[model samples]
Target chain A: MSTSLYPLASLPQIEKTPSREDGIPDGLEEELRAYGCKLIHEAGILLKQNQVAVATAQILFQRFWFVTSMKQFGIGDIGMGALYLASKLEECPIRIRDLINIYDLLLQRKAHIRAQAMASRLASTSAHPRTEFKYTPMSYFGNTFYELKDALVVAEMQILKRLGFNLTVVLPYNTLVNYLRVLGLTSREDVCTKAWGYLNDALQTPVYALYSVPTIVCAAILLTTRHLGIGLPSAPENCWWELFDAEWEDLWNVCGYIMRLYRERTSEDHTRVMGMVAKKGVRQWLEEHRPAGGEGH
Target chain B: MSDSAGPSTPSRKRSRWDIEDEEAQLEQAQQPVKRRSKTKSAKTSPAPEQTRSSAAVEPQRTTAVYKRPPHSIFVPPRTLHPPLMPSRSVYCYERLNSIEEGSYGVVFRARDKETGDIVALKKLKLDEEKNGFPITALREINSLMVCKHENVVGIREVVVGDTLTQVFIVMDFIEHDLKTLLTTMPAPFLQSEIKTLMMQLLSAVAHCHERWILHRDLKTSNLLMNNRGTIKVADFGLARRYGDPVGVGGLTQLVVTLWYRAPEILLGGSTYSTAIDMWSVGCIFAELLLKEPLFQAKGEIELLSMIFKLLGPPTTHSWPDYHTLPLAKSITLPPPQPPQLRQKFQYITAAGIDLMSRLLTYDPEMRISAVDALKHPYFSESPLPKHPDLFSSFPSAAAGEKRRKPYESPPAPVRAADYNLLTDFDP
Candidate 1:
């Protein structure tokens, strides 16, 4: 028998972020990633995907950017591809048709929101804070629809290749719940809800790829308890994080990243980042590099 | 001075600018330049520019190896180099012959071009894929990685073809599957040989369960054997990780082949664990002994009848939750009768009977686990398991070897009377 490739000890490591090397401006990579993760979350909800699948898709999207540049690939195509692949991995498969339609719908909704924001700024209206927007689904038989479909297929393979077929992602949500139960903190509604929110927010960052599941879980719990002003045993001899193989340094690092995610959320505008990176979308790039008679059909 | 200067003038000019341009182009071709060193050496004597450029590029290539951060949690300490490279193309291996096509994928016996090593390649069926990549393939790959053991088949790597539909999984090629071995062998395996095969199978199953994976489909055909007596468990297409809550929709009922399926599954049980795999292991155990499948019935009803005949009807004592099953209300229970295990295998030792009976128990909770079965006294009894290396080898049918003919026997005698001869003799 051949030696095992992906022993727990030797799983693929978090790669160096190539966005800076590819000349993407500082802080923009994080904005693009957050935008991409949001795309996965909204599309996942629209398609009725479970939390695990959505979380897995978010991690895949973050990991893809670790080796690839946002300038080279569009966030929408890669985000859709990640969701499509994650659903399969989690055993809750969504048809590609449904996936494409929902993804296009979400993109249109974002565009509508952005257009309204632009129109309101132009009209200089401060009275009307909210405007009702109705969504019109894209035509299934249009060229744009087929182009997106082809881009989705190509993006799936591109993500698979860029990630080196290491599709197994161990999520920390289950670990967090189990740890809470072990600590006899399941009944603490505030702590559970806060920790759950922290875990969801952590997906928008690179913490999922950078740290182990236990460390992430510990960070979430630690941050939640501190924020709620609830105390847990932290004495050196009986510290809780050590039981889950989480060091103090790693836990703090994870907590800091998660905190930064909330602190920096105010500056990122979706329309500006989308305009900056979506100049040569993944679909256009695919069409330019597409072989004359490829097998995608 | 003029003779030497005239010959060297153009050459010196070429080396100044042209060599630098060539070096720039070579640097953009990220693959290491070692492959072109031989051609470079062959032409370097004629052109000094070629020699100078080759020397300059060598040192730059060597420094290109990536270094991980000191405190990086992603890179494991033991691996000096991780497989960050893209998957190799499927063309790297030449297809020797087609192996059996399964529900999830089609397998082929292939030879690696560089290594000349024979490997089994399973090409996933993506042509009819409507939901993107299939979950079965994902589960199979994930479980195989998590449950790596000496007794389990090793997955080499995943390679891809030109199109999206052409992903292939490379695995170690084994000589025979136990099902074909049983039918083709001249005689049934001796007790000692059976013990060795069983021990290996149990070890593999125990390894999988230890890692929280369930090989939902376990049959003789999925058990691969080498020329030596070692058996490696293969075919994890139906395998999956099982844990608390058993995922969103719960476990599916459409798993494990009908003949090897556990009773609870046939009775519409949705939540199952390692017990289901243990039941399949029991079916495989029976097949190994009988030299055929234990329950060869055509349908689920007939299979249940066969199982009832061998292990007796399920009573409250045997299966406490039998009536709680979804299908329990529709089907009526058979009349109570004793198990026919002793009658079926009268020659087996007491310890052997005990182990088999424990494996084929009516209640899944009562079924012996793979780890416990490994410690059974039957293995330590007289005529113990033969050493895998000491066992004789047979020509592999998968390699296209002809079978050896068995010795001829006398024809059966025709009887004039159809009645029982023993009763006539007594009268």
Candidate 2:
């Protein structure tokens, strides 16, 4: 009932990674999660959702994957479902048709980029002219569009059911703003903007699900101040993070996660992961891990 | 620990001590029932063999059958997990009767088949929603979860039916709604009883406000009183979190019921806050004294006129930001006159009148907050608020109990004119 019901220390996913139990490699699991969260962010932008709605969607997606696994559920379907559900939770309702079209467009865009990357690599190797790729939008009357729509609805219910219908997600943006004002840093536009940017970037990882709002906000502030070389009031036993109830270790840990997100070779990881999944084909991979009843279809 | 769920469990299942403990740990606070604690203990100490045996003997007694793994999403393909225990099917409860229908949902009195506990099941209306789920219902559930207090109605769980459209919100069933109680009673609540009810209402409102939630709709109908005399604030469909930006389009103008609506909302103020809920509380206070809605106007214009007549026209001194409202310029101000609050409630004490006036102040900034209202002298006067336990119980109309006619009372008057004539004749 309380927002702090699942503290950072007590979350089941934080306690034990579910993907690992499903035989997924640790590094690959982390990339898949980051990619899934990135998909939510991109889908949110395509759907023209507000930051809170987008953040809520990202957190829901992360929370869903924490309990479930990529082996069983498709990230694209669940990510779209998270956004669709978050739009409703945050009182910003996105129509099913618009959601489906935008998601389709996003997936196509990703495929197009991958195709371009492959074409460039092949051209460089064989000294052949790179091929041009023209993208076509999904048709309203197409079977694929209708099928995607059905998948979205089913995925939404699955997400809701899996998450136990606890749809209220407390995002750190509000906390960041509040903390900034309290720390007398609101006037510093650079610090405020940087902290906010850190929050947006932090969403790429599982920080939102694993860390409390105050901890995340404090981490953002710490990261922002360090980046800008801004001095904050710090005396023995009166540390600023301590005032916000953020532990010293947690603040640094969140910062480390955000930094790792930047240092990771995301494109290379994405290529390898996609190639790994591609060997079996996405459909066949999903089919192999599908639960007996095909409940989420 | 098994003793907690033993033979005595049926009667002593939801003891007050359990509720107090649940409330003490607000973060993990769930229903007063013993299922959660039982599950928690079962998880830590593996007594599953005994639990399974008990489950076999008394299938309905053990809620362990409903438990799924804490983190697994596909324990059985499509089942839910801990905390959101697979929402038991709606068929788990037997419908007693329809309670009432609201714009957002329909209420029904139902009995839990397993526990035989009575609960109020609110079936959200999803058929007309073009949007996947109504934001109002989401806000209601969110607010209810956030603002959990004894004075606030406790939401047990959400149960689903055969189809998604048949979602039902299970809440602790109270015996009577204040509106029905007032209409049926021969006499209005005594001053002490009214004070007690107001205190309970104010406490609930204060609890919600402290959590940054606004119960935008507060009226007599939304107040439920149990046989024990405890009153709980209910119907949070119009409730939402405030203090943050209301988003791009701004908050909706339509919220509280017409009779209980605040002046700012009626005058097209888009950026209202907790003050609006305070205004509704003030109206409810007056309704308790008068045994009817304070403002029974048919439309916005008429409601505004009624408000102006009762509180006098809003002056520059009373409301500094009156001219800033969108619809402020459309109205012609009446000649200034003093508030007729004392004239309306002729028997109310000076302290009560002062408290009522503060709550009904024209300026939102000047309106009394629930926290401040709780410390007001009105509650400390002679004939102080009665304890909830001491308050007399009435026949529960919700349970279909017919009200006994008032002793030696004349036949009910058919209309206002007849009532007025009878009063005049008696005088």
Could you give the DockQ of candidate 1? 0.10
lDDT of each: 0.75, 0.76
Error of 2 at B172 (Å): 1.5
Residue by residue across A75-115, what tens digits does model 2's lDDT show? Answer: 78888888888887776788889888887776776776676
Residue A142 miss distance in model 1 (angstroms):
5.5
Q: DockQ of all candidates, in order?
A: 0.10, 0.08
| Residues B27-67, model 2: lDDT tens digits | 23322312432443344334433533343334234333432
Cα lDDT of model 1 by residue, B176-195, tens digit: 99999999887898899989
* Model 1 error, position B315 (Å): 2.6
Worst 10 residues of 2 chain B by lDDT: B72-81
User: Compared with the true structure, what per-residue lDDT tens digits does model 1 show for residues A33-102?
Assistant: 8878888998888888999999999988877876777767888889998998888777777888888888
